[model samples]
Target: MSKKKKAKDIMPLLKDEPITEKHIGILEENLQKVPGAGKKGIEKALETLRKLKGAKKDETVNWQTYRNEELKFEFKYPKELDKQFISVVSESWPSWPPKMTIGIDATETDFMCEENPNYKDESGYGERERVKINNAIYCVTSTSGAAAGTKYVNYTYLTIKNSKFITLTFVLSYPNCSNFGEDNKLKKCEAEQKAFDPNKLADQILSTFKFISQ
Candidate 1:
């Protein structure tokens, strides 16, 4: 008599097959049910599925890539983000075109990112936190202020890459998320702001940044 087809038996058949998050979820749900060798096989497949998910996300975005051969670094960003040069505009003075950018500077700065006593204003450089992104840990310094009643924000991502200390700076300026009168009537701000959120975009781009040589 032949044995029943188990998950381990089906895993080999999944080779080169496109797996979705739903498929991954199902596998994770059943992972505990299987024991021994079958369990190990599913665990390995789950890891592959997760990597495939990340690859699929990158493919769907079709973001533009920026590579600096001299620095051996590369990153990607969306087209909507590319056109950003907008500062919150007003009637008295038109806001200048958005100048969204990820400015980078490589220096031998301190790795600890210690706060300077001279910098009395806590808001100037709020706090330093260590975060891991793109397989590299960075000392992130975030600062924010208001300009003409608009929110002005900056992020400094400092890390050491290829034996050189590097800093990636990101800036964002956006008016408060509100609905004054889109259709001539007051309404609440839309709950979804993912499409235009610069901060979210910055994090996405940061994930794509890496040293090609490494």
Candidate 2:
């Protein structure tokens, strides 16, 4: 009889453990090994790692606003479509200080305030919706489209739940500025760069998740 390969025979299988500081530190070291990886380069690399790791957390990201800029991204939880809320906030990109906010519930997420109170008419709104699936939540959200010279931007989001676990995703900016006339053409524009893709962001956001007891 021929011997069969057991599951244990699988080499290089992945684990569900959370990312450790050690892993990030090793990555930093590798970056330094690259040519011309100076202090600034290392710092930028570390910052990128921090952002990537930070996105996986369940806490809200407090951000700052700018003259006329808007940004949106998703915040996911630990575990596969587990019980969690997604947050998508709008703010300036490459922002001196990030203008960010968090909504544990996407359906109720709000639009950001503009610099000028009078600009409210020109400001935008954010939206979120949810659905359920077996043992996992599949969500979708809008991201990245801002009205010129306005602080507020429209947003849409989705959430899903599976059994005892639920997962929520807040898409800050997708399907931007649908309502536009020839005059408002200047007000409506395509999505900005640096904003994470809704679907790709979903995967990346969920990749760093784990279930935590309430």
Candidate 3:
């Protein structure tokens, strides 16, 4: 007997398919119906779609490449990190992007990274002073041309260890989940999982990270 097909199974068949600008317009219209999905939120979704469309071939990899429960996925990184940090992320949520991506960027002297002290807590959660590291995290998701609408939950974190700047950003995202009314709650659920905390989202950010980059 054959096994039943799952959404995951269908994803790959459609992965390479591109989304059109007209499709993105549909997303913008649907997003307006959801509460709090203002101009900025709609723009965010559109931007994510653009990024996904702009993704090049070499920068792409599969979940199986980095396979592990916490580290069961492959991705493109624009920076180099200590072996330990890389391992931590790989083992923490390797397949986080699932069929999508978790964009990461690391550089030195980014205006944002330099202000660690301001974002840090009294207990020094973010950065003690200035470890001199910068990083960004993002994801791309779309349902359909070159640019499909998308939703991503991202974070920027900085950690300086062993005389090296270690900045790590990981994401859990859903692409092409923007058509709230057209599609089911898949996108909303994905967004909630990444953006909302178990209790209250505001509480989570304040309690855990102390700052919300998004």
Candidate 4:
């Protein structure tokens, strides 16, 4: 007796076939069963199918430019972020320092890593890596820590442009998962494993940064 064919066995045969409404309906029904299929799984599957059928690629991104006329610099950031431009002051000083900060509230996590002991000094905990963007080389360092029951991670890019030191800092917060480590650090956090990764999005925003010449 011949073995009955399974739906999985027949799926490969339709790989190159044109997608129809009926086909989409069947896929949608089974989408939840796919490995790693979560809330957006079906939508992503449909998008993939559309792309396979030669749908137009959507490369649109909404971005806003920030400029400082006196400083002679500018950069672009995603419009979706809750952002602000402000001057950072020293702990003891009330006056604004010479440096300007483009603060972005990622809002994904509630943990504030800024106050963590690991990031208390100028040079952070992580190893510095060199990154080249727009013909400029930047030294990047990242660190993560917890404060007041909140966990946070930060990346700082530093470079000298036109005889002035420039720094761009990116900070994000994540839930403290008790399932990982006693200290609840990111290295052992299982929540970080399943969480939506935002590092790529941060990189995309950083790529748009430029120092405009006066």
Best by lDDT: 1
Per-prediction TM-score: 0.48, 0.25, 0.22, 0.40
- Which runs of model 4 end up more than 4 angstroms from their true locations? 1-60, 79-124, 130-138, 159-166, 179-199, 211-214
Task: Please provide, for model 2 over 1-214, each residue's C-alpha lDDT reduced to its tens digit, 9 standing for 90 to 100.
Answer: 1111221222122134355587578656655565552345445545655676666753223322122223133233322221112224423432212222333533323322222222222233333334333333443333334545333233222332112123333424223333444444424333232243445544444433333333
* Candidate order, lDDT descending: 1, 4, 2, 3
Residue 88 lDDT, candidate 4, scale 0-100: 24
The predictions' CA RMSDs to the true structure, in order, are: 8.8, 17.9, 21.7, 13.6
Q: Which digits, one per residue and each the tens of the lDDT, describe model 4 over residues 1-214?
A: 1112233343454476766677677667766564542425455566666666566322225565667887567766554433121112223332111223443333323212223333444423544556556465555666765665645556666555444555666555545566335764645455444644444444555555566776
lDDT-better candidate, 1 vs 2: 1
Highest-scoring model, TM-score: 1
Q: For each candidate, what is the lDDT?
A: 0.56, 0.36, 0.35, 0.50
The all-Cα superposition gives candidate 3 an RMSD in Å to the true structure of 21.7
TM-score result, candidate 2: 0.25
Candidate 3: where is the Cα deviation over 4 Å? 1-112, 115-147, 152-155, 175-178, 182-214
Question: Candidate 4 — worst ten consecutive residues by lDDT sum?
Answer: 81-90
